[model samples]
Target: MFLDRVADNFLTQLVSEPTREGAPLDLLFTNREGLVSHVMVGGCLGKSDHEMIEFLIRGEVRRGVSRTATLDFQRADFGLFRSLVDRVPWEAVLKGKGVQESWTFFKKEILKAQEQAVPMCRKTSRKGRRLTWLNREIWLELRKKKRVYDLWKKGQATQEDYKDVMSNKRRAKGNLHPLLDVGGNIVTKDEEKAEVLNAFFASVFNSKTSCSQDTQPPELKDRDREQNEAPIMQGEMVTDLLHHLDTHESMGPDGIHSRVLRDLVEVLTKPLSIIYYRIIES
Candidate 1:
C-alpha cells in the first residue's frame, strides 16, 4: 500500500521536470479529492537528481520501520513497486547524454539496494517465477475495480454512498481493495489495460510545448506563431520552397488574391520557387 503511495507520489510530482536536477523540487498537492499528498525527501544528499529520487524511493519503502528496516530487511514484493516504476519512461526520458550516464550508475545502485534488502530473492527472482502470473491477475482486478468506481462516479453517486458500497464489497471479500487483492488472480480486460498504458506513455512525452510568457523566454515563445503559418517542408530544396512560399508576394500583408497567388506559386514554381519569408511588419 505504501508502495502504491510512493509510486503515486513519484508520478504526481517527479515526471514534469525536464531534467533530473529539477526533481526533489517542491511539489504542490492541490487535488480537492484529498488524493494529492506530499512526501518530503529526507536523508538525501540533495545534490543530484538521481540521488534525490533514490533517496525518496528508498525512504518510502523503509519509513517507520527502522528497527526492522536493515540491509537485510525483506523488501515488499518488487511487484507493486516495479509496476509503478514501469509506468515512468525512465529510459526514454533519461536518454539525454548526461542523464544516460547518471542512469547507468543509478541502476546499479538500485540493484544493490535490492540485493541488500532481500539477498536471496535477488539471486532467485532473476530466474523468474509463477508470481508474474499472479501480479498480472492483480492488475486486472485493479482495472475492474477502477471501472466500477468510474461508473459510480459518473452516475453522480455521493462519495459517502460510493464509499459505503465499496466498503460492503471489501467486507464481503475480506479484502481492503479488490484492485489490490492479495491473491492476485483478477483478469484484466485488454482495452482498459491499454488505456492505462497509453496514459502513462502520453504523460512521458507530454512536456508543455506552449511557451507561456511566464515559463519561456518571451522572444522564443511567440516567434513561430507570428512568423510562419505554413508547415516546414523537408529536403534541402523543399525547405527552400517553404521559405520562398513564405516570402512570395501572393501571401503579402493583405490580399484577397493571396490564396490564388499561393496556389499559382505552388504549381508554376514547382521546382525552382522556394518560399522563404517571415511575416514581420516593417
Candidate 2:
C-alpha cells in the first residue's frame, strides 16, 4: 500500500467503494477530514474500463482563477484596424531610424490599434470544452460497444461481436492512453498526466548549458564586401506574401496575428519593407 505516505502527510483516504472489479484501485486522498464525502463509483466514461469516481466537496473550495485572455476574432473591427494603419506615413516615421527602432515603432502602432479593434475575452479551460470531433456516428458506435460488452458478460454475445464493435472506435486520431507513474499509480486524468510528464522533463533539463555565444563566422574576404549592395525587396512582394499567410493560424510570441496582417497588407507592406531593408543593409 500507498497508505504509508498518506498517514505521514496527515491525509485521509476517503474512498471505500471499488472502481473496477472488486478492488479499491482508484484512491482518493484529502488533507482535510470531511472535506470530501459521498464517494461512489459511477459508470465508465466512453469505452474506458475504470469506473468514474463521483464525490462532493463539503464547503466552498475556491479554485484559482486564470487571467489568460485571447482575442475574440468574431467581433474584430478590421475596417477601423486597417484605417488606423493606413494613416501612418511610414517613409517619414521610419526615416533615419535603425532596424530595431523601425521594428519597435511598427509594433507599437499595430498593438495600439489591435487593442481597440480586437476585443479580448477570458480563455475557457479545456476541461469545460467538449471534443469537436466526437460526432453522432462515434457516439452511436460507443453505445453499441457498451451494449455488446454487456451481452458478452452474460454469455449471450460472441468474442467476434465485441471485436467488431471495438474496431470502429479508431476513427478519432491523437488518442491518449492512461499513463502509469513510476510508483505504479494510474494517472487517468488529463491534468495529472500532463503534470507528471512536465515534472519528468523539468527534472532532466540542463539549464546551465549555453550555446552559440562564441560561434560568429569570420568576415567575408571579398574586396567589395563593404561596397556590395543589399538585396532589393519590392512592396508588391511583401503584399503578396502577406496575402498568402493563413489567417487561421495562432498569433506568434510578438502578439501579432496573421489575420490582421492579411487584412492590412497594403498599410503594413511599406513599414515591414523599411524594417527589412534596414536590417539587410546593416
Candidate 3:
C-alpha cells in the first residue's frame, strides 16, 4: 500500500504539474510524440498492488522517464501478476460484481500490454459513490514514469522492446529494397507508397514532363572519388571510424555526409563473413 501511495503521489505530481515553456500537456494515451505523458495499468492475478508498483518503479527507472511517455494500469497489473504468487488480494479485488465490472473496462488494456510484452502494475483508487480506479493524475504519472512502458511503446517501448522492434525492423528492412537515391532527392519506392492511387497520381500527374538529370554535385563526386580510391579497412577499423565520425565534436552536414559515406562504403565493400577456427593441441 505504501508503494501504491507513492505511485498515486507520483501520478498526482505529474498531472498537476503546470505546463511551462509553451509545451502543452498530453491528455490522450496514444503514446505519440509530445510534452505530456500517458501511463498504463497491467498485471496478472494474485499479486499485491505494492509488488506491481515496485515492478513499475524498477521498470521505469531502467527505461528512463520522460515527459512524453507513461504507463497504462492494465499493463502494470499484468507485471504484478507475473511477479507474485497466486493468493494475493488482487484476485479478491476481482471477486465482487463491482470489481468484475471494473475488470471489464481494463480487459482490453491488459491484453494489449501482454501482446506488446511491456511491464505492468496493479492499481487501486478510491472506491466510493463514483467508481474511480484510475484518474487523470495516475494516468499522467504512469506516462511520466517512462520505463514501465519503455519497452512496450515503440515510442512506448521498454528498452528490450525497443531493441527487439529495431532488430525486427532491421531484419524486415533487410528484405526491403535498398533506398534509392537518384541525384540528390529522396524518393520512396512504389512498394512503400502508402496509397496506390496517390502513388499513381504522383507518377502520372505530379511528375514533370521533362526533367534534366542533375550532374553529379561536387561534394558527391569527391565522395565517389574517396570511395573509389580508399582501400578496404578491416571491419573493426570501419566500425571505429564510424564511431569517430558519429561522435565528432562538430556534427554538421559535412560530418554527417562523411559518416553516411563511410558506413555505406564499409557495408558495400566488406567481405562476406566466414566461420573457420583452427584446432590447437595444448
The number of the candidate with the highest TM-score is: 2
Q: After superposition, how far is residue 267 of candidate 1 from its true place, in Å?
A: 63
* Candidate 3 least-lDDT 10 residues: 273-282
- CA deviation > 4 Å runs, candidate 2: 1-66, 126-231
Report the number of the highest-lDDT candidate.
Answer: 2
Q: Over the full model, what C-alpha lDDT does candidate 3 score relative to the true structure?
A: 0.36
lDDT of 1 by residue, 1-282 (tens): 955875666543433332335443444332233343343343446554343322123223432322222122244444433343344444344333353354454444345434433333232332234343344446676686677678777985567766775686578432121121124333245555455556656765676534546684546454435433432322233333333443223222321122222333333232211121111221
> Residues 178-221, candidate 3, lDDT per residue (tens digit)?
23233423334655433443545576554454344774433533
Candidate 1 off by > 4 Å: 1-97, 122-218, 221-282
Candidate 1: deviation at residue 268, Å? 62
What is the lDDT ranking, best to worst? 2, 1, 3
**Whole-model lDDT values for every prediction:** 0.39, 0.79, 0.36
Q: Is candidate 1 or 3 superior in TM-score? A: 1
TM-score of 3: 0.13
Give model 2 RMSD, 1 decimal: 22.5
Q: Write the per-residue lDDT of candidate 2 for residues 1-282, one digit (tens) a residue.
A: 566877789998777888888788888889987889888887999988888999998998676564778788789998998898888998899888999888989999999999999999874555225354454566777798889999999999999988876776765555345566668576668898898888777766654332356767567785443433543556666776787786766689989999889988978988998888787788
